[model samples]
Target: MISAGIDIGSITSKVVILDDGRIYGSKIGFTGYNAERAGSSIYNSLIEELGIKHENVNSIVATGYGRNSVQFADKTYTEILCHAAGAFYNNSDIRTIIDIGGQDSKVISLSADGNVKDFCMNDKCAAGTGRFLEVIARALEIDLENFARLSLQSGKPASISTTCTVFAESEVISLIAKGESRENIIAGIHDSVASRLSSMVYRVGLNPPVMMTGGVAKNSGLVKAIENRLGTGVLVPESAQINGALGAALLAAKQNYRQ
Candidate 1:
């Protein structure tokens, strides 16, 4: 059976197609101002690219921040559940998940069977989120792609004491005015994000074999900072950015089978 999953996030939309139990194709695109449009566009793009007609798909599941926006979905699941499923699909050994999205961050504790045991989310604030990093990157006049490389070069990461995104941006600006090294400031930003995320991880209960999902998983500097704070290695799957969509696709296949 062929199944599809769409994850409409604040920053981007992703679509994954599963042929039977294995990945067939995937697509990613900016969500822009309309989640609904983004969802339809990305899904259609993927199906078209794969030369698969929509009618041939057996099931569809939507997830992430704009799950409800996918009017074409056969069903919808919360990102927490989907992320757990995705992590487990990647590695069943993963007992903890840290997903840092554009507008929010969350930590999910998973059972041995890949079920979500408990989860904590930071949605009321942008601190420690992808958007927080974006703001700092803009203030630093540095490309987001270079953040990880430059941060790794820092011998002494500068101090950024605030957890508030606005306050933190101002603090970064102040540091820039003070002629602080870019690498130090960038590393400090990653450290601050790690500090906030580590607290959330601890709150949800830290379990070994942690896996990080979402677009921020690509940030090696942030991952290293989190590892240092947690004192444990973190795993990043190759499909980290599309994990939620992958989970949704897996669930979609299961749903089809149950029918």
Candidate 2:
């Protein structure tokens, strides 16, 4: 059977195609302005990369923040369920999952048998997320890519007091004016992010091996900062960006079971 998974997140969209029992293709792209454009991009990827006809795809499960807006998805699943399933599929050893996305953050706990036991999500505030860091990066006159790279150079992270993104922008600008090195400011930002993230993990009583998913996981500096705060190395999946899509695809693959 052929199935597809489409995850339309706040920052990006993920598409996954499953043929038989294996992944046929998985693609990632920006969410753009709406889920329709994102879903069409996913479908285009399925056709161009996987050589699957529209009729071949039996089910398409939509997931993530914009799950409700996926017109083409036959069904929709919450990002919480999708993240847990995806993390389990990638590494069953993971007892805890931390996903830091563009606009929100979540920490999920899973049972040994692959069930979501508990989860805490921070969706209301952009304070401790990728968007917050992006704002800080822009204010510091550095691109996000450089922001990620420069953070690792810090011998010790400096302090960034403001928790709110709008205020943090002003703080970053003031730091720059005071002749603080951008690298230190970048390091400070990572430290701040890690502290906010660790707070969530602490709430769940972290269990290892911990897994970090979402676009923010792509930031090596952030990963290092989080690891330092947690006092352990974290596992990051090879296809970290598309875990939601992979989970959706896997869920679709299990549409039926034979007696």
Candidate 3:
């Protein structure tokens, strides 16, 4: 059976198509101002790219911040559950998941069977999130794509003691005025984010075989910082950004089977 999953995140929308349990392909695009339209657009684009008719999809699931906006989905699931399922599908050995998206960051602990045992989410603020990094990158006049690489070149990361994004931006400006190296300032920004996320990781209790899933997982500097703070390696899947959609697709397949 062919099933699909749509994940409508704050900054982007992703659609993944599965033929039975195997992936057909996935598509991603900016969410834009119309969330519902974004969901349908991505799904339609994916199906078209796969050369599959809409009728061929047996089931559909929606997930992420805009899950409910997907009226076409057969059902919707929370990102926490979807992320756990996706992480397990990628690596069954993974017992912990750290997902940092556009606006929020979460740490999830999974049971032996890949079920979510507990989760801690920071949704109230933009600090320690992708948005925070975006702001910092803009303030530093650096492209977001080059931010991580530049950070890695630093010999001494400047100290950024604040967790608040606004204050952090101001701090970065002050650092620039003080003639700090761009590399050092960028590294310090990553370090601050890691410090905040590591606290959540510890709060949820460290489980071995951790996997990070989300758009921010692509940031090598942040990954390194987190690994250093946790003193453990973190696995990042190739489709890290769409893990939630992938999980939703897997769950949709199961749901179809149950019926």
Candidate 4:
């Protein structure tokens, strides 16, 4: 059976195709301002690229912030459940998940069987999220892609005490005015983000064998900061950015088999 999963996040959309329980193909694209269009466009593009006919897809599951916007989805699942399933699928030993997306951050504790035991989300603000980093990057006049490399070069990360994104940006600007090294400032930003996220992780009761699944998982500097803050190593899967889509596709296949 062929099944598809679409995850329409705030900043990007992803689609994953599964052929009889194995990954067939995946695609990612900017979500822009239209969630529904982004979801359909990415899914259709992936299907076409794989030379698969629409009718041949047995099931489709949608997930993420715009899960309900995918009209073609056979069903929708919450990001929490999808992230947990995706992490477990990647590494069964994973007992905790830290997903830092474009607009929000979440910490999920998984049961021994890969079920979500508890979760904590910071959806009310942009602080400690990818967007927050974007703001800081802009203030630093540095490309977001270079953040990790620069952060690693810092001898001593500057201190950023603000938890608010706006204030953080101002603080970064002030540091720049004070002739602070870009690398130090960037490292400090990573530490600030890690500090905020670690609080949520602690609140949800941290467990060992943690996995981080989200677009920000690609940020090696932030990952290192989080690892240092938690005093443990964190795993990042190759499909970290598309873990939610993979989970949705897996769910689609399972549901189709049951039916």
Tell me, by lDDT, which candidate is best.
Answer: 1
Q: Write the per-residue lDDT of candidate 4 for residues 1-259, one digit (tens) a residue.
A: 9999899999989999999988999999999999999999999989999999998899999999999999989999998988888889899999999999999899999999989999999968999898999999888888889999999999999999988999989999999999999999999999999999899999998899999999999999999999999999999999999999999998898877323
User: Better model by lDDT, 2 or 4?
Assistant: 4
Instruction: Please give the range of 10 consecutive residues that has the lowest summed lDDT in model 3.
Output: 250-259
On residues 14-87, what C-alpha lDDT tens digit does candidate 3 reach at each position? 89999979999999899998999999988998899899998778999999989998988999999998999999
Off by over 4 Å in 1: 257-259
Q: How close is every model to the real structure, measured as TM-score?
A: 0.98, 0.95, 0.98, 0.98
lDDT of each: 0.94, 0.84, 0.93, 0.93
Q: What is the lDDT of candidate 1?
A: 0.94
Q: Model 1, poorest ten-residue lDDT window?
A: 250-259
**Model 2 reaches what TM-score against the true structure?**
0.95
Worst 10 residues of 2 by lDDT: 250-259
lDDT of 2 by residue, 148-217 (tens): 7898887767799988889988988988898888889999988888898899999988889899998888
Write model 1 residue lDDT over 71-92, tens digit each, in one string: 9899999999888988999999
Candidate 2 wrong stretches, greater than 4 Å: 256-259
True-vs-predicted CA distance for residue 12, candidate 4, Å: 0.5
Q: Report lDDT (Cα) of residue 65, candidate 1.
A: 83
What is the Cα root-mean-square deviation between model 1 and the actual structure? 1.2
